[model samples]
Target: MPTLSQQLLAKEAKYGASNYKPLDVMLCRGEGVWVWDLDGKRYLDCLSAYSAVNQGHCHPRILAALTEQASRLTLTSRAFHNDQLGLFYEELCTLTRSTRALPMNSGAEAVETALKVARKWAYQVKGVPADQAEIIVCDGNFHGRTLSVVSFSTDEPSRHGFGPFTSGFRIIPYGDADALEAAITRNTAAFLVEPIQGEAGVIIPPAGYLARARALCTEHDVLLILDEIQTGLGRTGALLAEEHEGIEADLTLIGKALSGGFYPVSAVLSHDAAMGVLKPGEHGSTFGGNPLACAVSRMALKVLVEEGMIENSARMGRRLQDGLAAIQTGVVREVRGRGLMIAIELDPAAGGARRFCEHLRDQGILCKETHTNTLRVTPPLVIDTDTVDWALDRFSRVLSAA
Candidate 1:
């Protein structure tokens, strides 16, 4: 008979879509920064479910909020009001320093919401002609996989066989302020970008790139939309990665950790000029602001701030980066990131990132590789110094052996 892991993998292969190439580890339970395999093997969680579990997995507070709210109310949709939605809005808006917010179920939905709102704002407020509005996007952006969101993608794997794509999107090289300035025209509606491109090997933009982009967007009257779904909610040692640049976007998208990995929750935060265009019946979601999600998200935010996870992320991130940098290995080409969202790029001559990732997995450390040769090493924000040291030791051993 097959082992539990093998049986599960076989079952998935037989029934599930062949969309993901997940590591062969079968994770059955997680808490804080550690996960257990089916046979009771332990591993440090380095990916944090792509930063969705920034507060760590199965947090007691978030779980309590989920259970409590679920017992009372779950879904009211947007057709009727729920008691928690208003408090969610108030708390979210106040925390993010935004005037308005629209809740959604996924990061992709938040991105879609932002796109629709930006186009509407362009037509109504910026005087752009209808159906002629163009939104500027950066290359290597991984906003989401939805059809409309994927329409502007420069990643070929995401775009191939998914067209004929939507129109009115312009692409520019990321971290190029001058390119952004040149791309703007009378019909440009918004400049959509990631503060630090998470999916593109954890690429950090040039210093002051966002500040310059913000200025250019302001001068050109184009809305600045920061896709913070991956980089927000204390993943980058701050409430939002935009804080590092000392700029605020006209529109901001956040998800992933919004519900502390207890639920699927995301939101589009907007200033008055952009979100004001949405009147009733224009847009909404069925499970967007459901009572359970709201209560869970509220507690998630509360715990993130009150528990000092952000500060711990900053301190541990520095330690992790320093430790990785000190590792003398021919395989590692570079180490770069902000807060817990770090990456180690391997030299192409040293095989690829997958081999190193597999080796680390064997040593009880869980991390995933992005692109071709870059290993993304984002542990949970709630990770401590000792765990960071343990993971770093494993990483050093793996790279040295490789």
Candidate 2:
């Protein structure tokens, strides 16, 4: 006879696509920063569904909003206006400080939306030749997994077997302003980048890299699109990671945490010029701005501000980083991150990160390994100092053993 966890894993393997290599534990419920396994074991959720639960899992306010809106009305699509869509737009724009907002169901859809808008803006506003406009992208970006999104990916694993892909995208090394400058041309319509590369081992860009990139975009009349799907809504201490660099993107992509992990909500926030090219019937989604998503996102944003989660992230992040740095472990090669999106890079000679992650998991701290050698530790923004310290103690023990 198999244990419940074993049975579930086997069932998933037999029935589902083999796209993910998840841990052995099977989570049944989550609240705030902790999740319970089927066996009723409690573990600190360090990954937060790749920062989607920054407001913490099953946030009461967001859950209430979801339930309330769902009971009243759910999907109206884009054909007819829903009462919640306009308020959603207003609140999202005001929060992100953008002039226009295009709602979508996932981060990939928002990325696709931005690409289309940028290309159209290039042809119509920048006088670029039709079908010739190019968009610059960073090398280690993980925007999304769509065919078009994967078209520009530099990761061989992501790009393999996905082509022949869409054209009009150029790649450059991340955090290199000079490389970016060299890559640009009159046909360049936008520079699509992650403010901090999240999936590529939580890589932080060089200081002033964003400022320089912003300046270059302005000089060349190219739109700057910041993909903040993983780093936005207070995951990186600030409301948006772009605020750290004191720069604003011409277009910003947000999702994951937008509905506080209660729903799949994403949006492309644009300045007046970038989004102005899209007329009605040009681009839309069936459930992009559905009433339920709008209502849930509204509550998510409100609670994030009212609960002081952003400030908590900053303070807790500093504590986490300091603790990681002070760990007396020779296996640790480096510790880096912004806010709660931290990473521990192990020495190549010390073996891969998976074993360390497994050890931590056994000790009840649930984080994930990235890029084989780095452990990404992104807790919920609502996590407290004591929980962080508890997690750190487990991390210290695991790293020491490794």
Candidate 3:
């Protein structure tokens, strides 16, 4: 007889859309840094649901807050006030050091909100002519897959057949400050970018690139929108990746880990001047900032900060990166990342990264590949010294064997 996982896999293939090409492991449960398959095999969780579960899966505190608030109240929309919303706003703003916030339900929605804010600010505040505003983006950025976001994308897969696309976006090479300056025009509204291109094989830009970009944005009066959905909330060892260069963005986007992987909660954290463009009825979401989301996100931030997950990320990230680099193997082309957002790039001659990932799965570890040749290792922030060392041993074994 076919196993339960096989049965479920067949069922999904028959019924579900083929949007994602996930690994052939059907997971049943997760806690802390580990997950179990339907066949009762266990493995470390290295992806963290693209950093949404940075606080780890099924955290007790976040779970408690979720259930308690779920029992009391769930949604009231923007028309009514909830008891948890104000507190959530205060805490998040204080932690992120943002003056204002526009709550949403996903990283994509937050990106959309920032785009709208930037365009509105351009016309209303910067004296740009109507419908002439343009936003500059990096070449290999993966902000989100929404139609408007994909319009600026240079990746063919994300853009093919998704258009006739949105307009008013200009493409510039990633990490090129000179290109950014040359691309800016009188109607340029904002410069949207990722500090480290997470989806493009964990690609980090040249040092001082972000600081230069920040200064240019200020000098040109262009709002800097830093999308931290994949890199923020301790994924890169910093509270926000912008802190790495000691720079601030006019609009900051964060999501994924905001609700500890328990709920779909995201927000646009904004500078006071840029956010002032939005009025009472200009924009909104039905489930954004609802009581349940607020409650879960509040606890998520608390445990992440109070429990020292950020510090752990910094220390553990260094240890893991060093260990991966120490592994002597002809297959490894490079090992690079900030914090726990690691990537092991394989030599093209050594086949693709997918086989290494499959080998990892069999060895009781779980990680995924990006851009064909790079495997990303982004375990939950709650991972410890022992776990990092343990994962390193298996990773070394797999790469060395190849």
- For each candidate, the alpha-carbon lDDT, in order, equals 0.93, 0.94, 0.95
Model 1 lDDT tens row, 14-117: 99999999988999999999999999999999899999999998999999999999899999888998899999999999999999999999999999999999
Query: What is candidate 2's lDDT per residue for 283-323, written digit by digit as tens?
Result: 98888999999999999999999999999999999999999
Clashing pairs in 2: none
lDDT tens digits by residue: candidate 3, 1-402:
998888998999999999999998999999999999987888999999999999999999999999999999999999999999999999999999999988899999999999999999999999999999999999999988899999999999999998999999999999999999999999999999999999999999999999999999999999999999999999999999999999999999999999999999999999778999999999999999999999999999999999999999999999999999999999998999999999989999888989999999999998999999999999999999999999999998999999
Q: Model 3 residue 353 lDDT?
A: 89
By lDDT, who's the top model here? 3
**Number of clashing residue pairs, candidate 1:** 0
lDDT of 2: 0.94
**Where does model 2 exceed 4 Å of error?**
none
TM-score of 3: 0.99
- What C-alpha lDDT, on a 0 to 100 scale, does residue 236 get in candidate 1? 90
Badly placed stretches (over 4 Å) of model 1 are: none
lDDT of 1: 0.93
Ranking by lDDT: 3, 2, 1
- On the 0 to 100 scale, the lDDT of residue 168 in model 2 is 92
